[model samples]
Target: MNKAPIVFLIGFMGSGKTHLAKHVSGILTGKVIEMDSEIEKKYGAKIKDIFSEKGESYFRELEREVLYEIIATNIHSTAPVLISTGGGTPCFYDNMEVMSGAGTTLYLRPSNIVLLRRLEKEKEERPLIRNKTRDEILEYIKQKVNEREKYYLKADIVFNPVNPDIGNLAQLVKEIIYSSFPYFG
Candidate 1:
Protein backbone atom coordinates (compact mmCIF):
# COMPACT_ATOMS: atom_id res chain seq x y z
CA MET A 1 0.00 0.00 0.00
CA ASN A 2 1.11 3.55 -0.69
CA LYS A 3 2.13 5.67 2.25
CA ALA A 4 -0.44 8.36 2.98
CA PRO A 5 0.33 11.98 2.20
CA ILE A 6 1.06 14.52 4.90
CA VAL A 7 -0.71 17.82 4.15
CA PHE A 8 0.74 20.81 5.95
CA LEU A 9 -1.66 23.76 6.09
CA ILE A 10 0.38 26.96 6.14
CA GLY A 11 -1.02 30.42 6.73
CA PHE A 12 -1.30 33.31 9.15
CA MET A 13 -3.13 32.85 12.44
CA GLY A 14 -6.91 33.13 11.96
CA SER A 15 -6.54 32.05 8.37
CA GLY A 16 -8.42 28.91 9.36
CA LYS A 17 -5.55 26.43 9.33
CA THR A 18 -6.89 24.42 12.24
CA HIS A 19 -10.45 24.54 10.96
CA LEU A 20 -9.33 23.56 7.53
CA ALA A 21 -7.25 20.72 8.90
CA LYS A 22 -10.15 19.32 10.86
CA HIS A 23 -12.57 19.67 7.96
CA VAL A 24 -10.16 18.17 5.46
CA SER A 25 -9.32 15.34 7.76
CA GLY A 26 -13.00 14.53 8.06
CA ILE A 27 -13.37 14.49 4.32
CA LEU A 28 -10.25 12.38 3.84
CA THR A 29 -10.62 10.22 6.91
CA GLY A 30 -7.22 11.52 7.99
CA LYS A 31 -5.65 12.48 11.29
CA VAL A 32 -5.32 16.13 12.30
CA ILE A 33 -2.17 17.06 14.19
CA GLU A 34 -2.25 20.57 15.49
CA MET A 35 1.35 21.64 16.05
CA ASP A 36 0.72 24.29 18.71
CA SER A 37 -1.63 22.05 20.68
CA GLU A 38 0.93 19.27 20.52
CA ILE A 39 3.62 21.59 21.83
CA GLU A 40 1.38 22.84 24.61
CA LYS A 41 0.61 19.26 25.59
CA LYS A 42 4.25 18.23 25.49
CA TYR A 43 5.33 21.19 27.63
CA GLY A 44 2.28 21.17 29.89
CA ALA A 45 1.65 24.87 29.32
CA LYS A 46 -0.34 27.07 27.02
CA ILE A 47 1.51 28.75 24.15
CA LYS A 48 1.01 32.24 25.55
CA ASP A 49 2.53 31.16 28.85
CA ILE A 50 5.39 29.46 27.07
CA PHE A 51 6.19 32.63 25.13
CA SER A 52 5.92 34.85 28.20
CA GLU A 53 8.16 32.59 30.29
CA LYS A 54 10.72 31.16 27.87
CA GLY A 55 10.95 33.74 25.08
CA GLU A 56 10.16 33.17 21.41
CA SER A 57 13.56 31.69 20.67
CA TYR A 58 12.94 28.89 23.14
CA PHE A 59 9.41 28.42 21.91
CA ARG A 60 10.66 28.21 18.35
CA GLU A 61 13.11 25.50 19.29
CA LEU A 62 10.27 23.52 20.77
CA GLU A 63 8.23 24.12 17.64
CA ARG A 64 11.02 22.75 15.49
CA GLU A 65 11.36 19.65 17.63
CA VAL A 66 7.62 18.99 17.51
CA LEU A 67 7.46 19.54 13.76
CA TYR A 68 10.12 16.93 13.18
CA GLU A 69 8.60 14.52 15.63
CA ILE A 70 5.18 14.78 13.96
CA ILE A 71 6.68 14.07 10.58
CA ALA A 72 8.74 11.11 11.73
CA THR A 73 5.78 9.54 13.47
CA ASN A 74 3.25 10.03 10.65
CA ILE A 75 5.25 10.07 7.43
CA HIS A 76 4.68 6.39 6.75
CA SER A 77 1.08 6.02 7.89
CA THR A 78 -1.47 4.31 5.68
CA ALA A 79 -3.99 7.11 6.20
CA PRO A 80 -3.63 10.80 5.48
CA VAL A 81 -2.25 13.18 8.12
CA LEU A 82 -3.28 16.82 8.09
CA ILE A 83 -1.00 19.09 10.09
CA SER A 84 -2.18 22.53 11.12
CA THR A 85 0.92 24.53 11.97
CA GLY A 86 1.34 27.71 13.96
CA GLY A 87 1.46 31.03 12.07
CA GLY A 88 5.20 31.31 12.38
CA THR A 89 6.01 27.65 11.88
CA PRO A 90 7.35 27.96 8.37
CA CYS A 91 9.23 31.23 8.90
CA PHE A 92 11.66 29.69 11.41
CA TYR A 93 14.62 27.37 10.86
CA ASP A 94 14.48 25.04 7.84
CA ASN A 95 10.86 24.22 8.54
CA MET A 96 9.49 25.18 5.14
CA GLU A 97 12.04 23.01 3.40
CA VAL A 98 11.44 20.12 5.74
CA MET A 99 7.66 20.28 5.33
CA SER A 100 7.80 20.59 1.55
CA GLY A 101 10.19 17.66 1.35
CA ALA A 102 8.04 15.47 3.54
CA GLY A 103 4.67 16.09 1.86
CA THR A 104 2.29 18.65 0.35
CA THR A 105 2.31 22.19 1.75
CA LEU A 106 -0.84 24.24 1.12
CA TYR A 107 -0.71 27.98 1.79
CA LEU A 108 -4.05 29.59 2.61
CA ARG A 109 -3.78 33.17 1.46
CA PRO A 110 -6.54 35.43 2.71
CA SER A 111 -6.82 39.17 2.36
CA ASN A 112 -5.46 41.49 5.05
CA ILE A 113 -8.91 42.93 5.69
CA VAL A 114 -10.21 39.43 6.38
CA LEU A 115 -7.35 38.69 8.73
CA LEU A 116 -7.71 41.98 10.61
CA ARG A 117 -11.40 41.42 11.24
CA ARG A 118 -10.92 37.87 12.43
CA LEU A 119 -7.83 38.59 14.52
CA GLU A 120 -9.30 41.61 16.29
CA LYS A 121 -11.95 39.46 17.89
CA GLU A 122 -9.41 36.92 19.12
CA LYS A 123 -6.56 39.22 20.14
CA GLU A 124 -6.79 38.31 23.80
CA GLU A 125 -6.00 34.71 22.96
CA ARG A 126 -3.06 35.43 20.67
CA PRO A 127 0.20 36.35 22.40
CA LEU A 128 1.60 38.53 19.62
CA ILE A 129 -1.41 40.75 19.29
CA ARG A 130 -2.90 40.42 22.74
CA ASN A 131 -2.33 44.01 23.79
CA LYS A 132 -2.59 45.79 20.51
CA THR A 133 -5.32 48.24 19.55
CA ARG A 134 -7.36 47.79 16.40
CA ASP A 135 -5.07 49.89 14.24
CA GLU A 136 -1.98 48.33 15.72
CA ILE A 137 -3.36 44.90 15.04
CA LEU A 138 -3.96 45.76 11.42
CA GLU A 139 -0.47 47.16 11.08
CA TYR A 140 1.00 44.11 12.73
CA ILE A 141 -0.88 41.80 10.39
CA LYS A 142 0.33 43.73 7.34
CA GLN A 143 3.94 43.72 8.49
CA LYS A 144 4.01 40.08 9.57
CA VAL A 145 2.20 38.88 6.47
CA ASN A 146 4.68 40.72 4.30
CA GLU A 147 7.61 39.22 6.20
CA ARG A 148 6.16 35.71 6.13
CA GLU A 149 4.94 35.74 2.55
CA LYS A 150 8.21 34.37 1.26
CA TYR A 151 8.04 31.37 3.49
CA TYR A 152 4.31 30.82 2.97
CA LEU A 153 4.57 31.18 -0.78
CA LYS A 154 7.07 28.33 -0.86
CA ALA A 155 4.26 25.87 -0.30
CA ASP A 156 3.48 23.40 -3.07
CA ILE A 157 -0.05 24.79 -3.37
CA VAL A 158 -1.10 28.38 -2.76
CA PHE A 159 -4.85 28.61 -2.18
CA ASN A 160 -6.48 32.00 -2.00
CA PRO A 161 -9.94 31.36 -0.62
CA VAL A 162 -12.25 34.26 -1.40
CA ASN A 163 -15.00 32.57 0.53
CA PRO A 164 -13.62 31.67 3.92
CA ASP A 165 -16.35 29.27 4.94
CA ILE A 166 -15.00 25.96 6.21
CA GLY A 167 -17.30 23.77 4.13
CA ASN A 168 -16.54 25.37 0.79
CA LEU A 169 -12.87 25.84 1.52
CA ALA A 170 -12.51 22.27 2.72
CA GLN A 171 -14.16 20.90 -0.39
CA LEU A 172 -11.84 23.00 -2.58
CA VAL A 173 -8.80 21.76 -0.67
CA LYS A 174 -9.98 18.18 -0.98
CA GLU A 175 -10.26 18.52 -4.73
CA ILE A 176 -6.82 20.11 -4.97
CA ILE A 177 -5.26 17.37 -2.90
CA TYR A 178 -6.94 14.66 -4.93
CA SER A 179 -5.75 16.22 -8.16
CA SER A 180 -2.23 16.48 -6.86
CA PHE A 181 -2.15 12.93 -5.53
CA PRO A 182 -4.67 10.83 -7.40
CA TYR A 183 -3.82 7.64 -5.54
CA PHE A 184 -4.92 9.24 -2.28
CA GLY A 185 -8.41 9.85 -3.67
Candidate 2:
Protein backbone atom coordinates (compact mmCIF):
# COMPACT_ATOMS: atom_id res chain seq x y z
CA MET A 1 0.00 0.00 0.00
CA ASN A 2 1.26 3.47 -0.82
CA LYS A 3 1.69 5.74 2.17
CA ALA A 4 -0.14 8.82 1.02
CA PRO A 5 -0.52 12.03 2.96
CA ILE A 6 -3.73 12.60 4.89
CA VAL A 7 -6.24 14.81 3.10
CA PHE A 8 -7.59 17.46 5.48
CA LEU A 9 -10.71 19.29 4.38
CA ILE A 10 -11.43 22.69 5.93
CA GLY A 11 -14.08 25.32 5.32
CA PHE A 12 -17.09 27.10 6.73
CA MET A 13 -19.97 25.09 8.24
CA GLY A 14 -22.04 24.84 5.08
CA SER A 15 -19.11 24.65 2.70
CA GLY A 16 -19.53 20.90 2.19
CA LYS A 17 -16.29 19.63 3.72
CA THR A 18 -17.93 16.43 4.87
CA HIS A 19 -19.69 15.90 1.56
CA LEU A 20 -16.54 16.52 -0.41
CA ALA A 21 -14.55 14.25 1.84
CA LYS A 22 -16.97 11.44 1.13
CA HIS A 23 -16.53 11.98 -2.59
CA VAL A 24 -12.76 12.13 -2.34
CA SER A 25 -12.68 8.97 -0.25
CA GLY A 26 -14.10 7.02 -3.18
CA ILE A 27 -11.07 7.81 -5.29
CA LEU A 28 -8.44 7.70 -2.55
CA THR A 29 -7.73 4.73 -0.30
CA GLY A 30 -8.63 6.76 2.72
CA LYS A 31 -11.24 6.36 5.44
CA VAL A 32 -13.06 9.48 6.46
CA ILE A 33 -12.53 10.84 9.97
CA GLU A 34 -15.14 13.47 10.51
CA MET A 35 -14.21 15.54 13.57
CA ASP A 36 -17.67 16.41 14.81
CA SER A 37 -18.95 12.88 14.42
CA GLU A 38 -15.95 11.47 16.21
CA ILE A 39 -16.37 13.88 19.04
CA GLU A 40 -20.03 13.12 19.38
CA LYS A 41 -19.37 9.41 19.36
CA LYS A 42 -16.56 9.57 21.88
CA TYR A 43 -18.34 11.81 24.35
CA GLY A 44 -21.83 10.53 23.74
CA ALA A 45 -22.96 14.12 23.71
CA LYS A 46 -24.06 16.39 20.94
CA ILE A 47 -21.78 19.26 20.00
CA LYS A 48 -24.35 21.78 21.10
CA ASP A 49 -24.51 20.14 24.50
CA ILE A 50 -20.76 20.10 24.71
CA PHE A 51 -20.71 23.76 23.89
CA SER A 52 -23.47 24.69 26.31
CA GLU A 53 -22.14 22.57 29.14
CA LYS A 54 -18.38 22.62 28.76
CA GLY A 55 -18.03 25.75 26.73
CA GLU A 56 -16.27 26.40 23.41
CA SER A 57 -12.83 26.38 25.01
CA TYR A 58 -13.26 22.81 26.16
CA PHE A 59 -14.61 21.77 22.81
CA ARG A 60 -11.65 23.32 21.08
CA GLU A 61 -9.31 21.43 23.38
CA LEU A 62 -11.00 18.21 22.45
CA GLU A 63 -10.71 19.08 18.80
CA ARG A 64 -6.99 19.73 19.13
CA GLU A 65 -6.39 16.49 20.94
CA VAL A 66 -8.41 14.42 18.49
CA LEU A 67 -6.66 16.07 15.56
CA TYR A 68 -3.25 15.27 16.98
CA GLU A 69 -4.23 11.67 17.63
CA ILE A 70 -5.50 11.29 14.07
CA ILE A 71 -2.32 12.75 12.66
CA ALA A 72 -0.19 10.42 14.74
CA THR A 73 -2.11 7.44 13.46
CA ASN A 74 -1.81 8.67 9.90
CA ILE A 75 1.96 8.87 10.30
CA HIS A 76 2.12 5.11 10.81
CA SER A 77 -0.56 4.05 8.37
CA THR A 78 -0.04 3.22 4.70
CA ALA A 79 -3.45 4.32 3.49
CA PRO A 80 -4.51 7.94 3.22
CA VAL A 81 -6.98 9.41 5.75
CA LEU A 82 -9.53 12.01 4.76
CA ILE A 83 -10.21 14.25 7.75
CA SER A 84 -13.17 16.60 7.62
CA THR A 85 -12.68 19.23 10.27
CA GLY A 86 -15.32 21.45 11.85
CA GLY A 87 -15.87 24.85 10.33
CA GLY A 88 -13.94 26.59 13.09
CA THR A 89 -11.19 24.02 13.40
CA PRO A 90 -8.68 25.69 11.15
CA CYS A 91 -9.18 29.10 12.66
CA PHE A 92 -7.91 28.13 16.09
CA TYR A 93 -4.99 26.57 17.98
CA ASP A 94 -2.31 26.27 15.27
CA ASN A 95 -4.52 23.68 13.63
CA MET A 96 -3.92 24.87 10.10
CA GLU A 97 -0.16 24.65 10.55
CA VAL A 98 -0.31 21.23 12.13
CA MET A 99 -2.64 19.81 9.49
CA SER A 100 -0.59 21.24 6.63
CA GLY A 101 2.58 19.77 8.08
CA ALA A 102 1.08 16.31 8.55
CA GLY A 103 -0.82 16.14 5.25
CA THR A 104 -2.41 17.91 2.33
CA THR A 105 -4.95 20.55 3.27
CA LEU A 106 -7.76 21.51 0.93
CA TYR A 107 -9.92 24.56 1.44
CA LEU A 108 -13.42 24.21 0.00
CA ARG A 109 -14.42 27.78 -0.45
CA PRO A 110 -17.98 28.09 -1.69
CA SER A 111 -19.45 31.54 -2.04
CA ASN A 112 -20.82 33.24 1.10
CA ILE A 113 -24.23 33.38 -0.54
CA VAL A 114 -24.10 29.68 -1.15
CA LEU A 115 -23.06 29.09 2.44
CA LEU A 116 -25.90 31.23 3.74
CA ARG A 117 -28.46 29.38 1.69
CA ARG A 118 -27.19 26.01 2.83
CA LEU A 119 -26.75 27.04 6.42
CA GLU A 120 -30.16 28.56 6.66
CA LYS A 121 -31.65 25.17 5.99
CA GLU A 122 -29.48 23.38 8.53
CA LYS A 123 -29.54 26.09 11.15
CA GLU A 124 -31.24 23.95 13.74
CA GLU A 125 -28.42 21.45 13.71
CA ARG A 126 -25.63 23.99 13.57
CA PRO A 127 -24.75 25.34 16.99
CA LEU A 128 -23.20 28.61 15.91
CA ILE A 129 -25.93 29.68 13.57
CA ARG A 130 -28.88 27.89 15.09
CA ASN A 131 -30.31 30.93 16.84
CA LYS A 132 -29.46 33.36 14.09
CA THR A 133 -32.00 34.91 11.79
CA ARG A 134 -31.56 34.84 8.03
CA ASP A 135 -30.14 38.35 8.01
CA GLU A 136 -27.86 37.53 10.87
CA ILE A 137 -26.66 34.38 9.16
CA LEU A 138 -25.72 36.36 6.08
CA GLU A 139 -23.72 38.88 8.04
CA TYR A 140 -22.21 36.21 10.26
CA ILE A 141 -20.94 34.24 7.33
CA LYS A 142 -19.39 37.31 5.79
CA GLN A 143 -17.56 38.32 8.94
CA LYS A 144 -16.44 34.85 9.93
CA VAL A 145 -15.15 33.97 6.52
CA ASN A 146 -13.29 37.24 6.36
CA GLU A 147 -11.66 36.46 9.69
CA ARG A 148 -10.79 32.91 8.75
CA GLU A 149 -9.59 33.47 5.19
CA LYS A 150 -5.97 33.92 6.22
CA TYR A 151 -5.83 30.43 7.66
CA TYR A 152 -7.93 28.84 4.93
CA LEU A 153 -5.74 30.38 2.24
CA LYS A 154 -2.72 28.54 3.67
CA ALA A 155 -4.07 25.23 2.40
CA ASP A 156 -2.10 23.35 -0.25
CA ILE A 157 -5.03 23.48 -2.65
CA VAL A 158 -8.22 25.52 -2.68
CA PHE A 159 -11.45 24.84 -4.54
CA ASN A 160 -13.30 28.09 -4.85
CA PRO A 161 -16.85 28.14 -6.11
CA VAL A 162 -16.53 24.36 -5.97
CA ASN A 163 -18.46 22.58 -8.64
CA PRO A 164 -21.69 21.17 -7.26
CA ASP A 165 -21.04 17.83 -8.93
CA ILE A 166 -19.36 15.43 -6.53
CA GLY A 167 -18.04 13.06 -9.18
CA ASN A 168 -16.30 15.83 -11.08
CA LEU A 169 -14.72 17.15 -7.89
CA ALA A 170 -13.47 13.73 -6.85
CA GLN A 171 -11.92 13.20 -10.27
CA LEU A 172 -10.35 16.63 -10.29
CA VAL A 173 -8.86 16.17 -6.83
CA LYS A 174 -7.56 12.72 -7.71
CA GLU A 175 -5.89 14.01 -10.84
CA ILE A 176 -4.35 16.94 -9.03
CA ILE A 177 -2.88 14.83 -6.26
CA TYR A 178 -1.60 12.09 -8.55
CA SER A 179 0.00 14.59 -10.91
CA SER A 180 1.56 16.51 -8.04
CA PHE A 181 3.12 13.34 -6.67
CA PRO A 182 4.03 11.34 -9.70
CA TYR A 183 5.31 8.41 -7.65
CA PHE A 184 1.75 7.33 -6.93
CA GLY A 185 0.84 4.71 -9.53
Residues 79-158, candidate 1, lDDT per residue (tens digit)?
67788999999999999999998889999899999999899988888999999999999999999999999999999889
Residue 88's lDDT in candidate 2:
90
Best candidate, TM-score-wise? 1
Root-mean-square deviation (CA) per prediction? 1.9, 2.4
TM-score of 1: 0.94
Query: What would the TM-score be for candidate 2 when compared with the true structure?
Result: 0.91
Model 1 weakest 10-residue run by lDDT = 1-10
Query: Each model's TM-score, in the order given?
Result: 0.94, 0.91
Alpha-carbon local distance difference test for all models: 0.89, 0.83
Clashes of each: 0, 0
